[model samples]
Target: MADRSGNNKKKVNQGATLKKVFERLGKYRIFLIFSILLATVSVALTLYIPKLTGHAVDFIVSRGNVDFPGVLRVMVQIGICTLVTALAQWLMNVCNNKMTYQIVRDIRNEAFHKIEILPLKYIDGHAYGEVVSRVIADVDQFSDGLLMGFTQLFTGVATILGTFCFMLSVNVKITVVVVLITPLSFFVANFIAKRTFSMFKIQSETRGEQTGLIDEMIGNQKVVQVFGRGEDVTERFDEINERLNRASLRATFFSSITNPSTRFINSLVYTGVGITGAFAVVRGSLTVGQLSSFLSYANQYTKPFNEISGVVTEFQNAIACAQRVFELIEEEPQIPEPEQAVVLKDIDGNVKIEDVSFSYVPEQKLIEDFNLDVKPGQKIAIVGPTGCGKTTLINLLMRFYDVTGGQIKVENIDIREVTRKSLRAGYGMVLQDTWLKTGTIRENITMGRPDATEEEIIEAAKASHIHSYISRLPKGYDTWITEDGGGLSQGQKQLLCIARVMLCRPPMLILDEATSSIDTRTELKIQQAFAKLMEGRTTFIVAHRLSTIREADVILVMKDGKVIEQGNHESLLEQGGFYRHLYESQFAH
Candidate 1:
């Protein structure tokens, strides 16, 4: 089922969105003003052709009594007008294209910048695909609508005004007839447009959901197949696709009505002008040439009404898409880093977690009144059951999440008082979930210390036990990989991540299940490397594998977010507590 609960509540103020769009357009006001000026010249010259044609018709007062020179002169002028009109329109379109794309470029840049500074909680709460759709898909949709409006909407309105002035100059009676029927087209288009906006908004949202679902399912297809969830996911996808289909149909059906309906009204305006002008010709108040001019003006005037009506529907859809794009650009970002914040340098790794309290949600407590202190070069291993806040503790220590109460200090300086960039630079973190950008293997390894020597890159890879595998590749360390490290096994990706941290060799390190993916033989080799790497560096290891942390200087075993046991491997076993039970259970199996 569609998420229809908030259908009536507007997601964004349309007025605000439009105002923002105009504000952006204001940045290129020179181009916009130039385009409009060209459009006016185009319309004015095109409208003048009808008057010149009327003059050409009047020159042929009576068949062979025709003044060929006068007719030829008017014909030349009409031809010149047509040529200039085409040139002006071409220039106007060029300006429109340039301005439209520049606006889209600005919007995309700002949206990406906003995503970079958004709080982690915001990212965690929304689907990755949904955010991607807004930046890529939604902006593209907005671009199409905007381009159409710029190309057609401005000229259509201008033509309508120009035609009205030309028609009035010929005869007021025929001009009034054209003007009277024009509002009928506007009324019909407005009625359809009002209904289509909501449908189009819903359609855009459904499309975003569809994009998000496809992204998630495709990215994790292996897990889906392992769990036999192909049909289940398919069924869910069909439901969303069906909703998008229905929304698109409704929006398209209603917006589609505006074109033919306005054309019908415009046709009536043309008919009325013909009939009224014929009567005026018979009464000698209008010449046959004047009647011909009025009929042409009627067609030109009414034609733009049809065009404008069509563009109004497109404009509605554009506004709906712009609302989504603007919402993303305006999402609450991370709290600003303070001015005069201390930049951590030459740091001794002495971490102190004071009476800290935290929870993902205020209503449900997770970790409360937690405290821990570590001296420089201490190897602190955290062991806990699932949901015991082991990863959360790491998040706090890295200042990815600040403690709700009290504070955490590095080198006795409160972490909040220090610049996050300089503070985070002091620690090297290797997580189980490995991420590699699309680049050569050497680039991935040297990500942390790009200035490292070729020998240092090889040394870090060799230390992490990945040099052998990398050396076997066709391109050696120059081998290209994707963001997800395509064609590489999970263990290989983890090894690369380890190599990244190894290359940095910061004063503090975090290894959160860093060796989880490697085989036992490789794990042992990497552990030996880690043993050397941990020397004189404060390291926090979050591990479920009890045997791996046996040599930790202190083991903090936790349950329900509180450390239940605080001791080393041998003493914890002697105590026969929760730590021993957890340790023995793994071996017992």
Candidate 2:
């Protein structure tokens, strides 16, 4: 009754995501064709063996005499069939594996590439672990599971069809009894599968959340320890883990019951075939060999019912995982690059932001009607409170997010006119939080300009004031930088990032507290290095330290994403506006 209720609204074989999976497999249709052909030959040969065995029994029993030579001939035929069937089945498995791994490879490649082009908003909105699970864990499960499930599904149904055709030829009356009962297996499988689809989906999500929690805790373990929230973190992890466990258990339990229940129904059909066959024999409607053949065919015909039930139940989880993966791969990527983009070459560095308005969310306006202008090689400093859209301006300029209104032009050409890669390449950036992959110091520093000569790399390092420190390490420039720039001080990491920007020597610079990690003494050296790097380039500096931007050509004091004060240092001080107050607050003695 429970299984019957479960099937009422059942919609298994999730069409949208499943369609994509087969589309990928469609590329290997030749391999699919061979596998099917082999499966056909295998199932055909195996089913013929029962017929041969039944004939052998009749050859001896009807004559009431030993017919060793005749029976041996039948046995020899069965042996030949079994051997050829085994070979064909082995070839089918090989084809299935070849098809499965290639499809998985393409999926994983597309998924990884999808991450590269995905909008930053998607990355920011979801937990890092959840995304990782979709790309890595969920993809792996979908591949391995569907590999097994799909092959079983194809061959299982084929075997059932072949067996039914053969059994019908043997005795239609008993075959009808077997055919009548098989739908019960389908009903139970469909019901349980539909019931567990959402549960498995929940399990995938819970697993992702738990994975994300682990990543967040481990990635920021230092902060967690500093704040002494170890117990709190554990409590949160345990709660997520508990939910995952429940989801997994329910999904597995519900799906698992389908196989045994379906098998029990098949067994009852097996009993019915035997009872009916015995009556036919007593009434001289069937021979003893025919009764033997009928029962053997009954098992062969009904076995696939049990296998198909199991496949459907198990494939539900795979379907759920695949859908999650498809959800990510199908997300709208960063708006497409312009079709006929203008080349950004020999940029003169003039920039104009006219009436640019932007908002991350529609209801919450971050920047409204903002405007700015800077001449070639000028330094522009932007200072404001934390949530006042300081970083949002950078995001707009880099085209990470497009502006909702107005235009930003470089050299009098609107930035949208050029390709994103070329536009970004025009500017060098060093942010407050530095990023370093696991590689040597030289590799991380030269990431922006991979073709830099050794001498050029050394010069850039010297410019960032990190050359002397690199010389002291055992491997010098080759010393490895591990996860989170392991074994290096924050200042060292910042210097490496600065060196990266220095090597590129772009036409423009954007420094967001790029020197915050440096000590007072190193700060002086870095500021000097920065002066060289900034020479003859348009520079935008987001600084909290008023002294860092005192010499700027123009300083803009921003509030709530709008500039409230603008002028050179002394001029702004003379005006005594927000800039003056902000500077005074920090410098007051």
Best by lDDT: 1
lDDT at 290 for candidate 1? 88
- Model 2: CA > 4 A from native: 1-13, 59-64
Candidate 2 lDDT, 402-490, residue by residue in tens: 89999999888888888888899999999999899998998999998999999999999999889999999999999987859998999
lDDT value for model 1: 0.90
**Deviation of model 2 at 426, angstroms:** 0.5
Return the clash pairs for model 1, or none. Answer: none
lDDT of model 2, residue 480? 88
lDDT by residue for model 1 over 87-195, one digit each (tens)? 9999999999999999999999999999988878888888889899899988998888888888888788899889888888888877887888789998999888877
Cα-based TM-score, every candidate: 0.97, 0.95
lDDT per prediction? 0.90, 0.88
Which consecutive 10 residues in model 2 have the weakest lDDT in total?
4-13
